[model samples]
Target: MISAEPFVSGKYLIDGNWVDAKDKTTVINPANINEVVGHVALCSEQDVQNAIESSERAYHSWKRTPLEERAECMRAAAEELKKIIEENVSLYVRENGKVLVEAKKDLLRCVDIMLQGADEIFEWSKAESLQGPQKVIVRKRPRGVAAIIMPWNSPLILTFKRVVPAILTGNTVVVKPATNCPLALMAFLHVVESHFPPGVINVVTGSGAMIGDVLCTDPRVRTVAFVGSTETGKDIIRKSASTVKKIYMELGGNDPAIILDDAILDEKAITRLRMGILKAAGQVCSAIKRIYVHESRYEEVVGKLTKEFQHIYVGNGIQPDSMMGPLNNKNQFDYVTGLIQHAKDSGANVKTVGIKLDPDTWDQGYFMLPSIVTGVNQQSEIVRAEQFGPVIPILPFKTIEEVVEMANDTEYGLRASVWTENEDLAILLADQLDAGAVFHNNHTIFQDLHLDFPGAKESGLSRETRHCGMEYFSDSYGFAN
Candidate 1:
């Protein structure tokens, strides 16, 4: 007897219909060696036009729907999304190469994000009443069909960040997920389509260069919410300017984590730091790329971190014991490995202290050993650039002001963390830091879904805030004097 496909439907969803693309795109499980786990239809220009046209058609009624009704639909969608968490969690681990446990957490986070938007963001959506003689109320309406270009890193959460909030605020969405990681988004869209009104949500997967222009340049697209590299974000901004649609961008980050001398080194702290640097193979946009340790504890910290790092099992995420998984794709793997090697070439001492990742299982896959590099010159590329990999460079610092200057020295400042026993110092450093958000005594990977998420300078513009989805979701909320 023969087995059946894990997922039978292999087409794109647009306007409440399962549609085919001009060509089929192969989706290989990142954990397995190019295993044909699933498939997604690659959208063409025509497909983009169709989805946008459908969104426009639905906007008239969707935007006009009472706030209560819209909120109910959002609640339903969130519930539906919650129900499929386990199913898509497995797909995320297999397709995106995240640890199976983390993958499950990612899906749960998505549901939590949606539920928050449904429960709280709507509370802010109501128009307030004035006391004097006149009822001047402010209301936030949907901006029409938003074009969300989601990144491959944490596909589920990134996709939910835009899709759930956009829809809950009455804006229809036409999503274009990164080709490298589209399965989770595709599955989530299916669940959403089943509950929401037709044409309210649509997902099309394909190369951005080809189909992305349609979303960026088209007049029908009222807003573009994107998460990716700074360069690509700029391109989207330039193109979308023609239509003058609102742009919300969450781009790259070269974040740092500071370890103060007074901080205690518990087993929990070392484990958290290790996970922060190596989670998702360090492909996370907010991963701790640079570790600035207090010179007093530098040696001890490195010794403890390396010892803990050695225990991580790297292999196919299907295995229960595997903690670290392979990189998303080959290009990312090569780029990350190149950065580590270049750091070594630049006189940085690189050390691998992880369960020896066997290459035999990844003959045609992307994989790398978790590594720590020390003796790195502060000015070197490894310390300065955003190497999105399971790697970290250690640099010693003596003074608080000195470390603060070093942390702000880089061009990218998306996020960072400060570990110190002194609450006053942590608060002071958090305020002075150039990054968007700073955590006290935590790794840079810490993310509260309800907080503001955006970068400064080259890191990007306008954050994705959690509680106040008002700014992120409102179609046009501005005041006139």
Candidate 2:
């Protein structure tokens, strides 16, 4: 068992003070389920009400604060977070079961996003004036209190991605981190809370099912920002309909990567594909879930991928040479394992790769080696569902037209990528993809802040990042003369 020096204290941040909830929930380390990382408060409905009321009371004053001053506070928070990145990275790995490298990337991305929000707020806050038959002025106003509901997969980044933008844009925020991995993010927020005024930022910890409806349906909360599964997003939309609140959802995605007949099967190309599937143990919203390779190169591509997967090292996050870590919780572990079994039972060619570094701890943890499933039916559960684990399905295609149709077959359209040496063909196939973001010769990952990162179709209801995101947190008012 790992040392317990960095145990997380179970407390909620309400009105700039650490307070306890009615009950507490223990957090387990996915790398070793026998290990207890810490505990978090399981807030009650009354606690949610208190948080919302506190945010409502602070919204007017915070929205009136100068944008320049708010930006300054954000910059200070970002710098303070940088100072604690190393410490938080260890906390992240222990709580979330991601390797050190992935944990570090998440920390860096959080800092980058905080700074980006500071810059974007200035651009998004600019007003517009026009003089013609009538003179008019339009300005943006904060949408009262914001409810930010985050997922566990990328807790730090997703939490801050909404929190930073909401507060910077003059909206007071109440954050709800996923119950499974709330410790790291709550600890990170503790460091930055001092930078903002009392009640400007608050976190409520508990079962989302118990308190999520309270946050969404509350009339005082003008904006609801969420990042999670598509089903949950739909429920939020339905609940928010009563109050008609502005909702920004970044839901689940089953992203696909296509390899053309003329695509290069070189090391770099294969590594890119491998990283797309293996990153965070494939527990990412935009991780490449499906791969459609031309029939001519399908066998060769699978061989290359299998060879690369053999070198992956799976173990506890703190292990020096470990490359991948266990799934974040038991539900996901069972879900992915069941999908793999179903595929095998259906005659799909399922192959497991990589070795479990600690066989003794395998059953004690939610660990699974990387797996590749080929010859899967297009309509199979493995193909239609989001595995959200370290398993990928590679399907063969005959023609560009057929592959394009297969790629766009799902209800999700979050992200897709095309691989080919021919620039003309790459662009041609990219344009045909139904996803919001398309990449050429690369897999989908975080995009630049300047680009819009919204999901199309059932993938999501709205967008995040850039000016588009800011619009979701503010309203426009017009003055005419």
Candidate 3:
């Protein structure tokens, strides 16, 4: 059993103070459900209100603070966060069931995000002048208090992605982390809150069902930023409609990867495919779920992928040699398992690829081997739904037009990639695919901070990163002299 003394704080960061909740909830390690990793507060409705009020009160003054000063605080917070990177990574491994390497990447990404937001403060807050107008000047102003709800899949990076930009643009924020994995993120926020003045940044932990509506529908909240399932995003939209507040949502994704006839089937290509499907155990929003390969290269590509999958090691994340870990919770494990079983019942060929490192502990935790399915119908549940687990389906297409139609048939258009040696064909296919972000000769897992990342159709409604990211937390006003 894991020791809880180091991980448990049993408190929430509100108005720059670590406040205790009336009740507490135990957090279990996903790799060993019997092991208690830590405990967090189950915040009450009154606690939510207190956080909102604190943020609202701070917004008035925070908005007027100089941009340079705000950036300085963010840099200081980043340095402070750097000091705890190793500890946070270990906590992340236990709390979220990600292997040590993946957990470390998540923590470092948070630092990068915080520093990047600091660097962009000046560019985002600069005033623009128009020559054609009558001395018109356009300046960006902070939206009042913001409510940021983060997901459990990648808590730290996603939380700071919104928090850093929101605070850097002078908007005070109240963060609500996913209930299943809140300890690591809440602890990190504790470090961050110390760098800022009281009430500038706050955290509330509890059941989202209990306090989500309260956070989004609150009259004082001017912006609601969220990253989760599509259904939840829709609910948030309806709840915020009464106040008509600005909402930025990064919802579900059923990303596709098209393998053209001329695509290389080498080690690099196989590794990209492997990482895209198995990274974070396939819980990422942009994970490659559907693959369309040219009929001629289908057999060869499958052979390569199967070999790559056979080499993955699955066990507890803290184990040095383990490559993948368990699902974040029982519900997610059950959901993904149901999808896999459904595909099997529909007459699809299912193959379990990876080796389980610890057979005795397999039943003790939410563990499943990486599954690869072939001969799956294009319209099957496995292909159409976001499994969000370590299950991927490979299908063959006769022609380019047929594959393009199959790829664009889904309602989700969050991200997609095309792999081909022909640059001209890659670009053409990318343009034709219905996704927010498309890549040529690569997978969709790679990201660039300076690019505009947004979703199309039901995938998402707003953009994040670069200018769009900062603007999402602010409003623009035009002044004439």
- What is the C-alpha lDDT profile of model 1 across 246-303, one tens digit per residue? 8888888888999999887899888878877888889888889899999999998889
lDDT of 2 by residue, 47-72 (tens): 99999999999987999999999999
Question: Each model's TM-score, in the order given?
Answer: 0.94, 0.97, 0.97
Give the clashing pairs for model 3: none
- Which residue pairs in model 1 clash with each other? 450-466
Off by over 4 Å in 3: 1-3, 6-8
| TM-score between candidate 1 and the true structure | 0.94
Better of 1 and 2 by lDDT: 2
Clashing pairs in 2: none
Q: Which segments of candidate 1 are over 4 A away from where they belong?
A: 1-10, 129-136, 357-364, 444-448, 463-468, 476-481
RMSD of 2: 1.6
Ranking by TM-score: 3, 2, 1
Worst 10 residues of 3 by lDDT: 1-10
| Stretches of candidate 2 exceeding 4 Å from the true structure | 1-8, 130-133
TM-score of 2: 0.97
lDDT of each: 0.79, 0.87, 0.87
